[model samples]
Target: MAKKPLSAWPWENLGSFKYAMYGPLAANVMYSWIYEDSYKHPWCVHILIICALRGFMHQLWNSYNNMLFLGNCRIKQQGVEFKQIDNEWDWDNFILLQGLLATMACLMFPSMDDEFPIWNTKGFITLMLLHVMVSEPLYYWMHRFFHGRYLFTHYHSLHHSSSVPHPFTAGHATFLEHLILSMVIGIPIMGSILMGSGSTSMIYGYVLGFDFMRCMGHSNVEVIHGAIFNKLPFLRYLIYTPTYHSLHHSDMGTNFCLFMPLFDAMWNTLNRNSWQLHNKITSNSGENGRVPDFVFLAHIVDVMSAMHIPFVNRSFASIPFSTRMFLLPFWPVTLMILLMMWAWSKTFLHTFYNLQGRLYQTWVVPRFGFQYFLPFAADGINKKIEEAILKADRMGVKVISLAALNKNEALNGGGTMFVNKHPQLKVRVCHGNTLTAAVIVNEILKDVKEVFLTGSTSKLGRAIALYLCRRRIRVLMLTSSTERFQKIQKEAPADTQNYLVHVTKYQAAQNCKTWIAGKWITPWEQSWAPSGTHFHQFVVPPILASRRDCTYGDLAAMRLPEDVEGLGSCEYKLERGVVHACHAGGAVHQLEGWPHHEIGPIDVDRIDLVWEAALKHGFRPVFQP
Candidate 1:
């Protein structure tokens, strides 16, 4: 490890608490406003607001660039993992430190301390000219100097650690680097102020514009089309694109201009292929390019959970899903977007990651979880699923698994509808319920000889019942239909057939300690379970643990292999690095090179086979307490 720079900031060790550095300054400003003579100036307050605005701008860029629907224009197709996320977690520290430094500079410099009008044309022009003549060259040289041997190893290399740059990557630098950056950035603003041309709007515009360009350069996605530069050829030398900055990271020897290619061109440091690469990325080079090995078809759980998507709020998505009080205020806006999606949006890729050199992606249907339960919305939901499956087939995706309600039996016979409709389709359609049943059954303790099962007539329930009966553990299958019970019972071996006992009332399981809940059970129904019962559930919005004495297992999930890469987001409520069983099942199918479609009924015989395969691939079950 390289030694820490002597210029490191004092609050470097504060972690998230570094924001407290702004507290004393803010309190002083508030005191002046409330009781002191400086109350009328409010320049201090403006500095605070600018700090917040800069942080918000970075977040907006980070979120927007990560949207997978905009994948075609992306300069780097690789995803940022937890390591990069952690490195950039403190990206806003620079903003806070710079705000403090700016406040100090205002107190020290007489010219910058005075207030000016809100808008000044002269100041805006001065800012722009000073930036072009002075700031750009200064930054260009400082950037190049940092890339040299000594500074590169000690400081600038920290910035270069992120191979795939993100918007926050703009601010993720060592203290010494940001200190120099703050000085370089302040030059144009200070020049405008020193010349008596500075105004409120000019400071705001100049600072915000600096942040905007910096973010644009590191966004990883190419938002600027090459056609604009084609029409105005000189503009290429004037403004740098995301691709230009990306080349600097990849090659580390060229494209060193801060926000303009003019300096790079003059210095002969510009990469010859910069414009060509930019055009290639923005134009979507290959018409039929880059197919994933597997696709997990998913849907939104609700308006709040919708915000939990990777592209929306990365920090929130990285952890398990939960309702956040801060997100409640944005619910109305999210609902509006959801409504718009329901009306027109189709299945779109949500995220992708590499596992064992194979690509796996998650594609989401526009419908929310509630829509799947609506009788009127079934046709619309199925239409979206079919469209996704067909698209996957055309892309040569080897396997596509239906997640959550997407594979509900009543809706599509566990994804069998698509296979039968398009019999010649090459992509394998998997409901992944077989492995889901396996995870749930394997969760039962070895010594337990009897289990009470609810939703026994459903696909998973039938498989679970038969699997348990084969193990010689008696299964109290709860169902109203004797014909359905008889059908599942006949599938079991004749010797174990008696173990699959059918019961109509929840009271029949009063003595059973193991309750497998496949359907939602009422509190009254749950009241009959024995005191020590454990509820292993497959039902969505898992049944409330109404029984205080009973323990509840989360929906079946498996931790991804240790070798999985770019898995920065969580799967619904599962823990980090863990995924829902169905998602893992699909991944296992792809990894095993399984040629058969894993749709329709859960084959009782293949339960252990799939479970063993999951274990072999380093996917461990998340056992319940």
Candidate 2:
């Protein structure tokens, strides 16, 4: 397994401390302002500023952890280019709606004044405490409702989309979920205003405290309870630690109570044994046993399948994209069309021989050539990568790795390698890339698990390795080749380290055959060649076939403009099953040769061979295409 380099500063700890210290400071300032003027506006302003500042700082910390630490951590455990499926819902819209509603509610409320009834000292404290009480149960109940079979599919599903939650992911939810949830906080404040039960100052304090506590609960950092507090059973009831909150995210049913566990304990819902239960479930099934795939599939069918009716069903065939826009005004139809076209042009057409030839001749090539190298250069393990690794692990597959030597080294002997000493399971480091290294990996991993490819290697090795990976064979890469190694590491998924085994080596026959034996089975149940350059060529058919299947429909659906308004007479058409820009404005050109050609079947054998080689060496392979 590989360790990803840290990319962000440690801001979460600092922000927490700053909030703790500055909160009292701001409160004191508010007290002084209120006393001097006997006016409530200044106090209200101070409270808002302090709360806003704390929220901002808290988010900054969260962003760093979610985007950098957690993101990298997941990649190290998983592979690059992975996606997770938890539930079906739109969390982003949910969060946005909640934010909008909260903002509106705040705006609707009147400002605090000296004569405000809630401004008195006792009233202020009570309001703050009540806010906590109300918010906890409200959120808990709403969350539980979302888990319900009926509502889970339509409303609560979005939050679960991110099985492993990130910071920004915290608020991503559906609009309906947000609307209902926001009212829990909003209604209380609104009622206080309507009844004039206390001073506006008191109400404002409660809101501030409510927000601060929510942020604290959601923070990923672990905060151990004080020894004294832990020892005193009753005191422990009052303090909710970070670990307590994190459990709620991981396990669905337990830890519903927020701020205080008293309510949950009274109802026998307090998940005091949640940690043990979580461990038990994970050990038993290797996944949280909340929802099954069939259940998720059903939900997807119910929601997205219905969506397909708008296209596949005859009732919708006559409706053009423009007409559909009017009917579904909320959807950004124009933007979606434009984005789809743009993506198609970049992904498929740009790689098609005839299209590339036409595009290059039209001067589009020079402008975009620099962008082509960006994915290679800026490539590092990201969230998607981690998702890939986890997805593989869930399928009960094991990843094997190989490290390639530096470019300066000769392929046959100059390049060094490393191999995993252990055959299967756990993280280990090896030192070089060579035939001996490959032998070491084969010996270690023999009869242990699957294989994966990683590292800068021959196109043949890569093609073979990729095929294996796609077929659920665990193939990965590792490299000691300085620049190439770093690139591979960077391109690895966030969760790679947790699942992938790093090895060093190069020999395909002796190491691979001995280890594979009868255990090796191709995805399609076909035998693959283990020797010769033809093995490399064998990998290509699968790659091209799979890519063609994956992208053909998307390419065919693209709607291009017949002519550009400003650009001189040029017409666009699909020629020989490829997009071409022809002479209204420029010279017509045909592709002379294949564009970005790949050779070989990329089957299980190739992946097994390359992966064994990588693990023998200390490095992993670059999993990205």
lDDT of each: 0.88, 0.34
Q: Which predicted model would earn the best TM-score?
A: 1
Q: Report the Cα lDDT for candidate 2.
A: 0.34
TM-score of each: 0.94, 0.36
lDDT, candidate 1, 1-625, per-residue tens: 6467544657878876888877876886888877987754466788889999998899889878777765557777778888888777778878987898888887787555466889989888998898889889999999999988988988898899987889989988888999888988899998888898888988888889999999999988787888888889999999999999999999889999989999999999999999988877777745423679999999988899999886788888888898989899999999998889778777777888889998899999988888888999999889999999999999899999999899999999999899999999899999888889989988999999999999999999999999999999999999999999999999999999999999999999999999999999999999999898999999997888787888889998888889998777888888888889999999999889899999889988899999999999998989943
Highest-lDDT candidate: 1
**Using alpha carbons, what is the TM-score of model 2?**
0.36
Clashes of each: 0, 103
Error of 1 at 222 (Å): 1.1
